[model samples]
Every structure is written in structure tokens, then in C-alpha cells.
Target: MSVEQVSIEDLGRELGERIAETPEYERFEEARAAVQRDEEVQSRIDEFEQLRAEFMQARQSGQATNEGLQRVQEAQDELHAMPVMSEYLDAQDELEDTLEAVNEAISEPLAVDFGGEAGGCCQD
Candidate 1:
């Protein structure tokens, strides 16, 4: 028996295309677009980011940022409360689970593990 020669890049590209065809991926894209169009959601996200930065800077400078931390938590909650953001988060989880399953399937035969490795867009 002869093993077939195949390009890893081609296989990866085909896998990506197949994943993109899934309904979960489509929903993820739609949810992301909805979030993008929501000004309130975007502002809440920006607020959390700015507060987080302030908290980090305070930590770096050995200063207190309890207020910033509290504000960041509030902003995070507000962002999470948005319907569009909630939908986006749900879709994101679904897509991530699907990709993890695919990665496991592909890595199993190759005797490798793709879980917990950094550098992917879904990095935790």
C-alpha cells in the first residue's frame, strides 16, 4: 500500500472552508456584525478597556486603582447585559467549541494536542 502525498496547507485550507460553511460559524459572523453596529455595546466595551488599562497602570506604578477596578467590573456587566453582546458571546462559545472538536479530531491521528496552545484567535 502506498501513502498519498498531500499538502498540509491545502488540508488546513479545506478544513477552514468546511468550518466556515457550518451554521454555527454563520451565526457567529452575524452576531459579531450586530455587535459591531451597536454603539452602546461598543461604548461599554471601550469603557471596560479604558478602566482595565487604568487598573494595570496603577498596578505597574504601585498605586491604588480600586475605583478603576470597580468601574471596570460595572462596565463589564453592562456590556454583558447587552442583547447583541450576549448573542455574540453565545455564538462565540459555539464556534469555539466546534473548532476545538475539529482540532481534536485532526490532532488525534497526528498524535498531537492542539488544546491550550497559544497563538490562535480563540486564545483564552
Candidate 2:
């Protein structure tokens, strides 16, 4: 075979071998999996946001009394312990941090009070 033809064949084989050995392909697969996890987490976050809005509205409208606040708190607790991928743990941590900030903002007195009602508050 001519030297040029032999060199071209060797180059193609080396390229294939290098591709097989590269870590980037595995990393890419991992990243794709992580992205899927993030997408699921995002959907959960949207649901939580909607639920939170409803809870807030109920409290604001005096529909949710102390019993209602307890229900909301229970829901928040469930959300705080939501499932997330290990690869996307950072994203979950960020979400937790954001929720803490929101809690702090709503921690002030007279902010959506749920007092003066001792009755049953059920949400279905």
C-alpha cells in the first residue's frame, strides 16, 4: 500500500480508538440524565408554586384559619422533602434555599395571618 493510504487508515483507526476511550461521551450521558432530573424537578416546583399560591389566597381570603395554616404547613413540609436526583442535588439545594428566603419574607407579623378560628379545615 502507498504510505499516504496506510497513514489515512491508521488515522481513522486511531480516531475510533480515541472516541472509545474518551470520557466526554460518558459525561454527556450523565449530563443528559441530570437534565431529565432537573426537568422533573422543575415540574414539581411549578406544582408547588401553584399550590402555594392557592394556600396563600385561601389564607388571605380568611378561608384558611389556624387549621388551614396547619394544612398549608403540612403541604410545605411534604414539598421540603420532595424527591430529586443525586446528580441534581445542587438544584434541589438551591430550591430549598429559595424557599427559605420566601419563608423569611413571609415571617413578618400581620403577613397573611391565620388566627381566630378553631374548626376543621380539610383540603381534598
Candidate 3:
């Protein structure tokens, strides 16, 4: 190939390095690290997951109850209320928005959605 015909792999690596240097990326990294280091946040997340699993099992066994549902909801609420989890979630949203904007810019010249995984129709 000619010198003018650069590989997409090289371009992708260059782009990734530049993106990592941005303040947005730094904030995301710091928030992610903080969340990981917070034992309280991790514990709450584990508890919430456990409660959710129990709820699912109960539902599958036709043994679901309002109390079980309430327990799961309460655990979820407690987890979301944690400062570390909230900050991490906000940072994650910011990062996703940044990525989507980048994708739009990348796809604009081609007039195509240069693309990410398309989600299923069913809502969680």
C-alpha cells in the first residue's frame, strides 16, 4: 500500500491514546477507581445482587411474595443511594455520551451508524 493508505488499526490506536488523555477520560478513571476501592459500596452491591437472585428464584418457583419484592427494592434503593455508586454511575453515563458523540462524528462522513451493538426491543 502507498504511504497515503494508512491502516485503520494504526488510526484506532492513535485515537484511543488521544481519547485517554482527555479530562473526561481522567474523571471516568478516577470515579471507577474510587468505586472499586469503596468496600461499603461493593458490599452493598453484593447484597443487592444476592437479594435479586433470591427474588428470581422465588419467582421461578412460584413462591414470590410482597416481602421478597420489598426486600429487593430496599436493597436496590440503598445501593443506589450510596455516594460512590451514584458518582460511578454518573461518570459511566458521561463516558457513554462521549462515546456516542464520537461515534456520530466518525459515522457522519459515511452517512452510516458506524456502529455499536443494537439492543433488544424488550425493556429491562
Candidate 4:
């Protein structure tokens, strides 16, 4: 079929399906599942999220302290130090890299940056 015969939405959906089948995507999915199934990682995530939320609330109320910000940073560091969390993060980064390369490829033939500028407006 000619390019004009396929709807943009259909092409987008097909692209998404193809991306989902990539090895990077598969690794990311597996790593995500492992993270979800690990109680220790989950607990650390919960702790980090709670600390971050409390920090945000304090900041919103104009009562945020350096100590609170430090606590949140420490919690984030501790969470990221976990083996499972590290693996998940690495897999996620690889998947993001793959997507970025695909985005560049798609953007190259277009007038705009397909991934970054397609929906944005008010540019000079």
C-alpha cells in the first residue's frame, strides 16, 4: 500500500507494536516485573516516594527545610543502590536510548523533531 493509504494513527500504532517487540523493550519489561516482585525494592520505593511527597508538601506550605530535602535525596540514593533497582534503571535507560534513536530517525525526514516538537507550539 502507498504511504498515503495508511493513516498516521495506524502508522503510530504499528511503530509502537514494533518497539514493544525489541530486545531492549523486552529487557525493560522483565526488569520492571522483577522490581515489582521484589518486596525489598518495593519497600524502598515506598519509603522514597513517601519522603518525596512529604518534602513536596512541606515546600508547598513554605515550611520546607534543608533536612527534609536531604532526607529525600538520601532515600533516593539508597533506593537506587539496590541491585534490583539498578538493573531496572539500566534496562529503562537502554530502552530510552533505543526510543531516542528511533525518534531521531523519524525526525530526520520531517520538517520538525517528530518526538520533541510534533505537539508543541509557540516556537520561534
Q: Against the true structure, what is every candidate's RMSD? A: 5.0, 21.0, 4.2, 2.3
Model 2 segments beyond 4 Å from truth?
1-37, 83-124
Instruction: Determine which window of 10 residues in candidate 2 has minimal summed lDDT.
Output: 110-119
Candidate 3: residue pairs that collide: none
Candidate 2 Cα deviation (angstroms), residue 55: 1.5
Instruction: Please provide TM-scores, in order, for all candidate models, with all chains considered together.
Output: 0.83, 0.33, 0.80, 0.89
Which candidate, 3 or 4, has the higher lDDT? 4
Residue-level lDDT of model 3, residues 10-122, one tens digit each, is 99999889889877788889998998899999888899999999999999999999999999999988888888888888888888888889888988887666665334556
What lDDT tens digits, residue by residue, belong to model 4 across residues 24-89?
Answer: 999999999999999999999999999999999999999999999999999999999899999999
Best by TM-score: 4
Would you give me the overall lDDT of model 2? Answer: 0.57
For residues 1-124, what per-residue lDDT tens digits would candidate 2 score against the true structure?
A: 6654568679667755664454544444454475566765667567667777887898788786776567657765665465443334555455446545544554445453222232457623
Q: How close is candidate 1 to the true structure, as a TM-score?
A: 0.83
Model 1: residue 90 alpha-carbon error in angstroms: 0.7
lDDT to native, each model: 0.86, 0.57, 0.86, 0.94
Query: By TM-score, is 2 or 4 better?
Result: 4
Q: Residue 44 in candidate 4 has what lDDT?
A: 91
